[model samples]
Target: MPYAATTGRSIAAVTLIAAAVLPLTGCHHGGGSRPGAPTRPSAAPRPPAPGDRTACTPEMLRFHARGVRHPAHRMLLTVTNYSDRPCDFAAQPYPLLRLGPGQRAVTPAIGPSDPGTVITLAPDATAYAAVTTAADGASGRGERISQFGVALAPHTAPGQVGLDSGPPVRVNPRTARVTYWQSRREAALKW
Candidate 1:
């Protein structure tokens, strides 16, 4: 019975020491708080600025010029069907070419004079439109302007007007247009 009591006391003493040391081990010993302790106030993330084109893509490439010469300026715009299912595309309003990033170039409030231009493509298929300019340039001859961007069809695969894979074409600012001698079909899918 004495040996059993001694063994019990030893075990109890060891358990008490272990319990006390375990808690102390967790206590921080440094003069300053632990390293990498998250004390810095979490930085408030800044919101994106208005009219920022951060989400722009190659398929949205588009530009239009019209004068008394041609009532409807011919536009070769690329369109993509992103979904697995086929999609039928109708004419979208001629996107106005803005000079700078902040300006609102295209207004959605204006209705199209004619909207029967529908083009259908199979799933994952990309198509191009030879669209006429919606804006009437009857007042004066607007010089040919070069504008390009990604296609903006909702839920559709992104498409581009110019080929981004090839060497960037240098455009003459004075000419106000970039000439691509390639075929229309070739130009549409290049980007």
Candidate 2:
């Protein structure tokens, strides 16, 4: 091919690429309004920003504990969002569990940690955690626990709640387990 033809093809290619990319450059498609402009609502709801995720404070949640009759050794603890705004919470794998009010040793998370897993609860929404107090025939220390505390964060005190019904819940903190905060009771129980 002649040099001129090669040069012409090169120019055409560059022009085509420039045309395609020009539209993408300096184009702001985010769901944000320009200053002093009439804001247009986004068609789809925007996900909460990272900064918007305030940890669910103790005051914002109400804890409840109840024995699972079907699952003899397991109990369900739920955290209901009593606040007016949405907030985020997660069991850093699992929350710090105290078998009893006087128990000083934080029951370590029993299973693998699911890092970065967080639950965002809206006002009035609830999250559940399935706690396995004592595994039958399992080794380690087993103690009868009628009351327990769930410290959502390291700095905060655990929110204690009594078993609403049934016998005293028995637990071996070393072998005990609590699932990460789940959106539903079924999910928590599955863990």
| Best-performing candidate as measured by lDDT | 2
Q: Residue-wise lDDT of candidate 2 within 27-132, one digit each (tens)?
A: 4664343457666666996777767666788889888888786575778888889988898874353667887645567765545434346788899999888888
Task: Tell me the spans in candidate 2 whose CA falls farther than 4 Å from its real position.
Answer: 1-51, 90-93, 101-104, 110-116, 139-141
Candidate 1 per-residue C-alpha lDDT over 1-191 given as tens digits, one digit per residue, 9 for 90 to 100? 69999999999999999987765565555333444665545489655454322322333223222121222233344445454444343333222222223323322222332233444445455554333323343313333334433334444432324432333322222212211211234332222
Please give the CA lDDT of all the candidate structures. 0.37, 0.75
Clashing pairs in 2: none
How many backbone clashes are present in model 1?
A: 15
**TM per candidate:** 0.28, 0.64
The per-residue C-alpha lDDT of model 2 at residue 73 equals 71
In model 1, which runs have C-alpha deviations exceeding 4 angstroms? 1-72, 80-103, 107-120, 124-143, 150-160, 163-191
